[model samples]
Target chain A: MTVSDPTVGELSEGEILARILARLSPSRALLGPGDDAAVIAAPSGRFVATVDTLVHGPDFRLAWSNGFDLGWKAAAVNLADVAAMGARPTALLVALAMPDATRASFVEHIADGLRAACEALAPGCAVEGGDLTVSDTLVVAVTALGVLDAAAVTRSGARPGDIIAIAGDTGVAARGLDLLFSHFTDASGTPIAISPAALRSLSDEDGTALSRQLRPFPPVALGPAAASAGASAMMDVSDGLVLDASRMAVASTVTLDFDRQCVGDDPLSLSGGEDHALLATFPPSAVLPEGFRAVGAVRDVGAAPVTIDGEPYDGESGWDPYRDWDSARG
Target chain B: MTVSDPTVGELSEGEILARILARLSPSRALLGPGDDAAVIAAPSGRFVATVDTLVHGPDFRLAWSNGFDLGWKAAAVNLADVAAMGARPTALLVALAMPDATRASFVEHIADGLRAACEALAPGCAVEGGDLTVSDTLVVAVTALGVLDAAAVTRSGARPGDIIAIAGDTGVAARGLDLLFSHFTDASGTPIAISPAALRSLSDEDGTALSRQLRPFPPVALGPAAASAGASAMMDVSDGLVLDASRMAVASTVTLDFDRQCVGDDPLSLSGGEDHALLATFPPSAVLPEGFRAVGAVRDVGAAPVTIDGEPYDGESGWDPYRDWDSARG
Candidate 1:
């Protein structure tokens, strides 16, 4: 909005890219940016690759989530997917589509967030290549690639006697979501910009939850450690514990029986999502790795895919709140 | 409106994915779709990677382009980038974001085109994994990965005495673009649905040009062939010959001198783009690859980056058609 801070439309793509590249970490790939394509070393003969997108809107992306939050969240989500496969992320390819009227400084902040997230959560992983395009809605699509340190940990490898464990927060992000909706919405329930006073009013725990919601730090390194520890099945828990556990159960053809004591008694912890935890099944004799705690055990197929303390969880699934969220999102 | 043909909103994401998977080719990766992330083999220890996006709009995407056309173009464009790196394309990760009201059949058609393009242009390649999300506008962001057979070619490898060659059509897609605007647009210049009668009126040459524009068959195989044949530099010519040639010149710190006989006199051949051709530079004594034809030669840095018939070309660059297309696009 000021003379010094020009909009992206006022400059060329080359200029915008130069500014962004300056803020990003130097590439460590075989070939980095500025070429027709980047060449990355996938030394183990195989690489894990996954992509995820974040689209902007009032109900979807929180109004208080700035450019940095959006960039970090996008990278974090995709990195979690690669990590869930028991791989150590090495590179990322980003595709950014935004309105031309977007401020150039905002784009720079996004670059900074991407670099910071990679360094903090998955060190040695850097953005090697990307695409920039114009669109009516702002969207960030990121592809994460990593090399497997061991065999890929798939969801279908769990055995009936395996021990289920988790390595990240359960419902802290969901609690942040609660605080966001409760405190950041206007009369119409649409998200609005955060006030400094409002942000300062949160309790220490609430503030921590909100911070986790904005910039999630999924246990990236724990994925390979779990695999090395002889984990059988693994998955990234983004759609609540019970919902994702049910998926693992279906894939492994077993039942996920969670102990209430380990999983916590909070309803949100069971059905709330966006935590992006690493859930894995280890042999009964395998020692739990650092940063991991036992949650429950895999059981023979029962009447239901998931149970809590010997009974089928009769409550709604984590996805029940937004089965049609993708369809209904603006 | 029909009972059998439901919209995407009428079905769950799982149901839609099933329909799409049924239409795609069988996965060839180490571990394909359905897992947390696809495991692709990079046998040579290195993989080439790039991402590109196509957004729906009037001036950007022709209204007459169908779902199949959109999918095919998306795959071809990304393939060209990987091929330009002098590598063989191995997999594609597509992120499709469309409106909720999109028809299920349309999505299936997109899947079909994705498979068809790989089969036709780059065999052994397939859609390895992707992400689906809801957006206010339709967009396809594709990430292409490839493995180098010989060595990765780059735009900066050109040197004096290198022979410039092209492996695909030039100006043909631009011709089609001209017809698209002339025959498909209304008075306000907004593209509309194609009229069958109007299409029938085109001559053979025009028909071929239009088809190439809709579904480009870039010389994907020729890229690795050029590299193996000892090409010094290579690139994908999506922006006209002179413009992209100028880029290589600047990158290589050399001047390009094109022979009128090989490059032709048509202005479109020099300045028009969207052909997705593989352009390369080979040693003067090196035998040109089977599919390539000599178009120019490389020289030491001069006053002009590009010249024709020993004189600096006065004609405009290919990007002259849309200097600010991205910034002005919706």
Candidate 2:
């Protein structure tokens, strides 16, 4: 069926499930959906589990994102968290809550997006199982399971004199979000409906930035590689470079110093969120992994947890979901 | 803090999480909360995973249930799914979404309910980690992980001539729900406000039924016991008995025949939902485990997937969440 066809309210739960499951192919699960539970092989003897939820109003706007984008972002964000733990994602369990009036094809497109993300970002990771329920708003909750191939690279492992490095893009998603906000809203900050054709006609640079926002490319492979390479500590740069670095510093009881010259003209690289880049600290003398670029250094425990270019950064730390909507808009 | 003190909007996400985490005591997970992901031991080399979502309007009503009740019910339902698989629950991951106006005390109570359930029902099980997000309505999504100690019992293992038995309450939750519905609504089906004191004054029998509806105690241990006892097939009766039995019959390619006398006076036993009982089929000569009572027998594949007393029995099958709201209310 096409994307605009039959609404889910017109079909039974069993039928919708059958259609969605048919579109998914699980490669890593011992036993996939259709059972009471899915069996996932955990040969490493330990499983790393993380869960994240995306709500429609706070996380995404239906006008700005389609089912495919929603599904892809959901998978990418969770997979990034799994990668940050220095593990390889093995399976994903999705629990979706949507209004009954949602189109059946929308759900199918979501499945397709999940499959595409798995194939592109973390091959062999499967959509093991999921639950679907009716709600007034759309909510996608993903619980990702991974296997630790090496010692877990926790945020608490950073030590004094460690060199900080990063893998994948930083601040791109934040830029994309800014562009979308501008394109969809009028001068007074009120939302104005924009046609799909108009959105497609935007400048190529804007289109590229929007894609980054809609579909982040987290460095899933580099996580385990860094872990194996003896990285001291690691985490995904989700909230923002400066804010997340502060978190790592506090966890490790050390101080993080980011070089302003290395961060470049993009102030966003220091404060933008949703980049999903791998941020790791390696021993000062250790050889850096291939994809990672040196951006900062770990210093001895100091008065402040994080600083930029030897001085404290006095700017917005990062995005906070609980902030008032008006303040968030600014 | 008391149950009615502070609203969640008064605190930042970090503050809320810190408060919630302080109340949780995790015994089964290798790592619980505070990191990118929680680590769960999977000594069996495999993990059984299941997820369920409870939406405010569709799955529950704040007018009738409290935060503690919501949390307890969420944990119980997911744990029951793990138990149905003949596995022991090891860890739980929660993804909660709610409006900004939600009370901090309410969230705390939910966490308390989750902790209480793990302590009381499945000792040693832990709330390993979770995600909290802002939404327009309340949604609780839980993903439970279990370890199979013995052979994993599936619904597709029943053979012809196997005796059908069940271990736990039947139709009680449905009856309890009916009682609650009748109490809160006028004869014309319009909602009428019922005071908490009046609700507390319900007859002992009615109170028992309501508790079953609000806090189901699934026969978790019996599932593993049935597996050890060499039961041929097993499943949880989450839906009504006939509908779920039909599912088992279809999976095993056998016909299930229930004796009317065995089910007794509660016709709801044959067609009610949320019982969370372990239903299994075993060889006729095998001794029934304690708590399991014979209810039927497995037969060769026939015209219909299920029958009662050697003849087809026609009645309303069971609950369907996707059914129209009015019909579902009935």
All candidates: CA RMSD (Å): 2.1, 2.4
DockQ (Cα-based) per candidate?
0.62, 0.79
Q: What fraction of the reference interface contacts is present in each model, in order?
A: 0.67, 0.81
Q: Candidate 2, clashing residue pairs?
A: B8-B104
Question: Best candidate, lDDT-wise?
Answer: 1
Can you give the lDDT of residue A301 in candidate 1?
94
Off by over 4 Å in 2: A1-4, A186-201, A324-330, B1-4, B186-196, B324-330
Just chain B of model 1: what TM-score?
Answer: 0.95
Model 1: pairs clashing at backbone N, Cα or C within 3 Å: none
Q: Which stretch of 10 consecutive residues in model 2 chain B shows the poorest summed lDDT?
A: B321-330
Best by DockQ: 2
RMSD of 2: 2.4
| Model 2 residue A38 distance off true place after TM-score fit, in angstroms | 0.5
TM-score of the second chain in candidate 2 = 0.93
